[model samples]
Target chain A: NAGVTQTPKFRILKIGQSMTLQCTQDMNHNYMYWYRQDPGMGLKLIYYSVGAGITDKGEVPNGYNVSRSTTEDFPLRLELAAPSQTSVYFCASSDITWRTEAFFGQGTRLTVV
Target chain B: EDQVTQSPEALRLQEGESSSLNCSYTVSGLRGLFWYRQDPGKGPEFLFTLYSAGEEKEKERLKATLTKKESFLHITAPKPEDSATYLCAVQVESGGNQFYFGTGTSLTVIP
Candidate 1:
């Protein structure tokens, strides 16, 4: 199983540029999440979905949005990127409940100047 | 508010040194505690999951034990490849499936 996959392994954006970080999972999980990890810091959730078409905000959701129109895809969009958003972003997915381990993607390194 | 605290932010040990890392957390209706290891520039890899107080799980040289208020990751005869940041997070029983992660404990095993 391709587990979890994220695209654009690296990106550099101007202060106002917008882009989408793509994430897809083949595990048929019911839960998907997007998190950002600042250098030397732990990850903070950006958004999460319990199932396709159901999305919600997480601890840190500013400057970002997500859509889960399909069970296999959860894309995170950064609107007018800022230097503060220059961090490594990871996409993860888990099973139907909160009792299982979430699998993470390789991660996307975003740099805003 | 939910909180997670990881101790000794960073640790350096010679190969074969045995040590432990602590993770203290507070949450509403603790659902589960998860441990993951991350290498630089890489995503976290699942290590173990502890569900109840006094629960324990082991893999290779790493052992994770949990209590109501905290959890400990014990490393026995560590090797260089085992050196990486260890992260602990909790999933509140009602907090949906979102996880709040601790900053993580960086362990460096030197040869």
Candidate 2:
């Protein structure tokens, strides 16, 4: 159903480089989130948006920023990328009012050298 | 503060063996508990969600049950294809669109 889609399956960046990970959902969900997963560590929330034009920081938002310009898109931007930011990034969306399960995208594997 | 913890960082079981993974959580007025299975190089797949204590849900060889403090994902006669990382997450009623996740339990069912 192409529930959630993320671009750039894999990426490599040098220290201090900046890039944006694109995420889009076809489910028309109002709640969208960006999370990063590291080896042996569970997924950590980076940033989230409850609806279009609304955004909020999550547990690990130090090096990342997110924007929700439309209901179908939530892009995560990494500024001055560092090794610590090298992790798999996943985007998810859900219908908060329905309390439904969140659907996740394939994920973007980012490696910062 | 909300927190989620999963036990047995990793487990290996022979095909057809049965075992249960644990997810302990603490939240301010629990609203929902979620279980997801993630394969290597893939995003997590939603498995089940429990809204309140004493709730139970089942699908194929997996059964998830929840209590006040914890939830359990029991795999019955699992197959090698069932090998994946199981993640537990919690959402609080008072929180605003925040879901707390555990490190996850990595399970490998060997043939």
Candidate 3:
């Protein structure tokens, strides 16, 4: 079903630059999430949306913003990027039923220098 | 605060050896506990989901068991191809289905 897909598998950003990480899912999931995984650490939530046009901040949403314009796409935006934002970003989607597991896309590796 | 902790951080074993990875969690209300395997340069792949205590699920050489306060991912007769990082996550009943993840346990199976 192609599950979930992410764009720009790797990127390097200059300090203060801005960029967006794209995520798309064809599973018709109502829930979408963005997370960042640092080396030697667990994945931390950045932002999430329950459905289209709905978005909310997550545990570590300081430098990130997100928008869910459609049921199939949720994009994470980084404004004024900092070195602390360097990590691997993952996008996941799941059905509303809690019993279903979230499916993840191939991560995007971001480096801020 | 909701939290998930996994141990022993990393493990190395012979191909035939078997072991278990632990995930302990503390949250106001637990909706579900999940296990995933991640290879280098790739996102995590789902393995199992336990919704209640005493529930157990199995896939190939891996079995996941859940308790009131913890979950265990047991690997049986591991092979070198099983080497990867295992991650645990807990979804809370509150807070819009936010998931708390643990620092994964890196497994190395040597042939």
iRMSD, per candidate, in listed order: 1.0, 1.3, 1.0
Tens digits of per-residue lDDT, candidate 3, A1-113, equal 69999998999999999999999999999999999999888999999999999999988999899999999999999999999999999999989887678899999999999
Worst 10 residues of 1 chain B by lDDT: B91-100
Which order, best to worst by DockQ? Answer: 1, 3, 2
* Model 2 CA deviation exceeding 4 Å by range: none
Every model's Cα RMSD, please? 0.8, 1.0, 0.8
Best by DockQ: 1
Off by over 4 Å in 3: none
Chain A only: list TM-scores of all candidates.
Answer: 0.97, 0.97, 0.98
What is model 3's DockQ versus the real complex? 0.80
| Candidate 2 structure quality by residue, lDDT tens digits, B21-50 | 999998888878999999999999999989
TM-score versus the correct structure, for each prediction: 0.98, 0.97, 0.98
Candidate 1 residue A85 C-alpha distance from true site, Å? 0.6
DockQ of each: 0.84, 0.71, 0.80
